[model samples]
Target chain A: MATTVESPGIRREWQRFTPRQRLIRYAFYLVAVAALIQSINSVDIIPEFLEDAPAQIVDLFARMWPVDWAYYPKTVHAALIETLHIATLGTVLALIMAVPVALMVATNITRWPALRLLGKFILVSSRSVNSLVWALLFVAVFGPGGLAGTLAIAFRSVGFVGKLLAEALEEAHKGPVEALTATGAPWLSLMLKAYWPQVQPSFWSIALFRWDINIRESAVLGLVGAGGIGMALDDALNLLYWDQVALTLLTIFSVVIAAEIIVTYIRSKII
Target chain B: MSTAASQPVAATRQNPFPVNWGARLGWVALVAYSFYAASLFELTWERFVVGLDNGAKFIGRMLPPLLGKWDLLSKGLLESLEISIIATVIGVAVAMPIGLLAARNLMPAWVTWPTRGLIAMCRSFHPVIVAILFVKAVGFGALAGIMALIVASIGFIAKLFAEAIEEISLKQVEAVRATGAGFGNVLIMAVQPQVLARFIGFSTYQLDSNLRNSTMVGIVGGGGIGSTLFTAFQRFDYDFVLTILICIISMIMIGEIVSGWVRKAFQ
Candidate 1:
């Protein structure tokens, strides 16, 4: 259906492939696949319990079939709210903090190469570390709460927003900046009047996009006790409350979808 | 204020509705809710101070990260790298057909709907959540982590792949079709060349991301360095945890560099 062809002539033509062509195509795939299958069989990668995985998954789904709706109001609601809060607050804070870093990293803005390198290093390091790991570190530092989760989300977002923002900054129309600078505009005024204006639309979109991503990241931060629906999820999982777990997962899915819709709508409006 | 002398600059739009009211409302609501949320979370200055003290101590302990657990470290790293490579290969391979089917421009609604839905479901949950589910299903190990990452890899790349296919110039596909070529031949002759570079880029990026997530899945007992790091944390082996973190970060950075190189090389 992907192709426009409507007739069965394609299959008949497929069979007409020369033997040599077929052999060459099949041989490589066959060898690679055989090696993959053989390695799986040879390695201890598969555990004994894996044989029962299907059955266990079936059982697990059965247990989770009827989500505990009652759990939402009492347990999940607040944590879900906390997760949303973490995402929003984190994205906002990250955007604000990223402004300076973005400027420093943008070659057109920063004068010193060393400062640019420092900015790039900060972005790379932040981007490289997973939010969960940051949450783990923050949990140890802040004793596990929304603060830790919020901070984790913020720090993780810094690299992402900063990198994109810096690129946007560098790519901003130099025409305006050069025009303004020639008029003897100070650095701050020139940036505010020239650079900021150019990147505003993109910055808005990136901020929204980052918020959408942060929602996904913060949803899982609770697993490490950084506080959110995820911590509740961790608790439910630990207690084997499969019904509650199902409910939590559903909440997360809905929130993600909602955020996605929002981002789509905003980007459409802007662009 | 300074723009007053600029004689109504082009940046100053004449329309009263130039401001995006919806966005303004969004910002206001976000700020208001942040304050309310802060209160609910009890994010206090006093608590922050105490936390900072504890964090300082934690940092102090992490200064000289322990590198003594070479066996555990290398084993987990090797497993993670293996998991990443295998997952990327399998995920990209499987995603190709699904992506083709999911491209709304190429396929009928019925076909695209189910395929797109599948991609969405794959993407709905975070990798860690998926890892948790797989760990339970597969009874904990690198296999579970591998399976989770595969699903993640598929989810991450398939949507992009579908978009790439959708964006392909049908002019080329039509020209191939005009030659009375079979569908497969048309795909190879036209569609493949345009999309292959992008597919490679997405695949490499997925691999880089998978490497990071692979180290993380073990936190929930799915298997890898995360498990070791989690245990060190639980046992209050801050030094060891720090060491694992450094390793993980370095590995991720290396993957980032490699993937960047791959993308640049192709470009």
Candidate 2:
């Protein structure tokens, strides 16, 4: 047995981070600070406008007060309905399109690496381009309308739904799959009997979640002439109709909250 | 015994696959609604076929992407990058204290309630809408874009950060308190360590989103590549539009890589 050292002879202390970690952290901070300084320097901010911001905000809000409640029944109602239609229809379209992509992406379902990569490429391209960008493109090709908005929402949502659905598919339990395979079930039968039941709850949940997001997205697609409430908002803004703008904003806020509530309630029941 | 067993089997022999009535009804309603909505939009198959024809031509035109306007493209890209970085930095910095105050586990109900309300209001509006307001207020440019993105980052990061803080182990805080540490000390030592990695993760995610948004905010005159893109679209410069899209996608992919690296490094 070795003898223990005397306590007074040795120095003991505590260190929160190693030298390497501390260096790395300091370097990160340095880069961030540098980037911030450079960005601030490059951004063209007029001193006058910066100073006048508070006054400008106060003036804007002053114009927005006493919202145009009467404007709702006149124009906003139809636009609001259109927005909901676009959201729901687009979500359904996306669900239909995403299922195949999700199947291609899921490793457990599609054993080929090349197909999975292709699936990933589709998803990434769809997601990287913002919904508004997609709307802009669709509007150009389709001559602008709710059709364009619906297509944009569907295209944008495919990536999100496909990604999540693929993950859920991958996480399906192997026991049922093996059992079905041992019973000489075909691929389609295996998928339906083994994987579908396991992922059904998550599939519905993901659909609801995407629908909630689609509502907010479709509400703004009209700014690009794709159709919906944003068209009214765009019109009001151009006309300098602050009251109407305010009313539209309020309508959108309420719709978003309502969608959130509905989704949450449905998800709780289903999941 | 055999007769009794047979009777039990007969009684138990119900439908092997019972149908869900509610689900059936839901499907029917969904289908009916789809038809009605499609009719309202006039989204007929003929329209789709014509649009598909246009789309094919559009894709054909986009094949030879115009790379001639490097200067204009670079300028817009730089502006977008600047807006994203500035917005992300300011947003994350401002969100820190707000997130701390909004954490129900750390703060009183009164503090959390108001802070959470503010966060909700922030999150309710789309960034483009907020950008329009900022453009009007600030008279358009990168500043408006930056401000809009900052608001977005704050809304997203603060709520997530607050949730993270709330989920942290309270025992660490108790231990720090038992050591006669001040509130600030306790927060720095006990709270910061636990949440720092997650905070970094959230900030990086916000940065990625901010970058994506910055490119589009210019369409509303918020000063970025979006205005240029909108102009190109209006001018029917399909090739240039394709180039811009490609650039945006590549930049986003790069940002994803960088953010993933940062997350790994921090972890």
Candidate 3:
């Protein structure tokens, strides 16, 4: 029944479907494509309206090439270092804050409905707001620098690390925890002896992963004056220094790629 | 010799997370760097006190968020919606084919390598950076934001799609081929069914992401609520900034809820 080859001479495989099924499929695709086209048209990005777009883009790139390689020693190097510092410090701060929050949010650990709800709320609200907005807020308050950037990254990461680690804590095997409780281990001791071991891999993975992301984030936080390589890039663009912009971008690209490679290597070795 | 061998086993039982030299040294260096950077940034208690005073004033002004700028707010919101929807739709459509082409299980190295490289380039920069590039390319407005997000969407969804396709069981594909089915028949009968659910899940998630990203792109003159929000901040219009923040947060939370429902319905 599965192999329904009709003729030996034919190379084509035809599906025998009812007319209604074919009609429905066609109508479904037609509707989907039509809606998509409508939205595209609504955005009004048609090339016809911007006849010189290609030329402008070509000119922009032509201007950007032959990057100001000399810009590195003056500013790019210091900016790159600050960006890495922001990511590293932020990740550590987030991890310190997230541990207790993760425990409170995990259903198996917290047990109290109200506490869990509060923890979940913190996680959701933190994750919901983009880091740029957080950076903006901190910039307004702190008047812009690497401190604001670090705090923004930390706040943004708390939710991510907490949420994932909470899931990890909840999924841990119950047998060890129960055994520790039966033996009258203190709450701290029980967690240390039982939960910590099981959730260690997940906790570290989330921490490292967030650090990698923070690297990318802190790179651009300077656009809002949070202080990083992004500030340099933003300034260069503002001044219409396309060559400097090109150099800044290239530096950012290499830094991000290097971070990726480092994280991958560490993860492989550890995980 | 036997006692020495047993000594290491006893030590293993004492720690839940054993500290290797690499991790131990990593920790020491991280702590050292933290203090170094803190000093470099000149973090002082006196400075913090001044910052706190400013923060209090900012918060005081932010209360009772003003909603008087309905004209600008609604216009920006509508444009952001259009940008996200159009970007998501177009990005997902383009991604589907590219994703399939990039599937290592289905494609030759020559095809997968270049397609994967393109996706990587798309993802390397944050959306705001890409938006800046596109704004410079296409000129400022929703059009540039939409274009940047399409590239962002393609980068994200295509990679996940390719991974999903790679993970599917190939037995069904083999069986279809054994029946002398054409390549299209095999794909339709075997490959499509396996990956369709996951594809939908990725698409919904991408839309949710695009919506949040659309707001921020406007800050770089890429057209969205972000531009208004940026202006409000620059002018120190704390109440308006508060209102914009509330609107953005609510939209994101609603997106989260909607995507959750989408996943449930599809599952």
Please report the candidate that would top DockQ against the real structure: 2
lDDT of 3: 0.87
Q: How big is the positional error of residue B67 in model 2, measured in Å on the Cα after superposition?
A: 1.2
Per-prediction DockQ: 0.39, 0.74, 0.44
Of the native A-B interface contacts, what share survives in model 1?
0.56
Models ranked on TM-score: 2, 3, 1
* lDDT by residue (tens digit), candidate 3, B40-69: 777788878998999999899999899799
- TM-scores for all candidates? 0.88, 0.95, 0.89
Per-residue alpha-carbon lDDT of model 3 for A157-179, expressed as tens digits?
99999999999999999999999
Clashing pairs in 3: none
Top TM-score hit: 2
Give per-residue CA lDDT, model 2, range A141-180, as digits (tens): 8988999999999999999999999999999999999999
Error of 1 at A9 (Å): 44
* lDDT value, residue A262 of candidate 2: 96
Candidate 1 vs candidate 3: which has greater lDDT? 3
Per-residue C-alpha lDDT of model 2 across residues B1-267, encoded as one tens digit per residue = 687586887666677447789988998999998889889989889998999999999889888999889888988988999999999999999999999999999899989999998888788888999999998898888999999998988899999999999999999999999999999999999999999999999999999999999999998899988999999999999999999999888888898998897887788
| A1-271: candidate 1 lDDT, tens digit per residue | 3434456655333343478755754664575467466545543476578788999999999989899999999989999988998998888779878999999999888899999999999998898888998998988988878989988999999999999999999889889888888989898888778887899998999999999889999999998889889988999999999999999999999999999998999899987
For residue A172, model 3's alpha carbon misses the true position, in angstroms, by 1.4
- Top model number, lDDT: 2
Off by over 4 Å in 3: A1-38, A41-49, B1-26
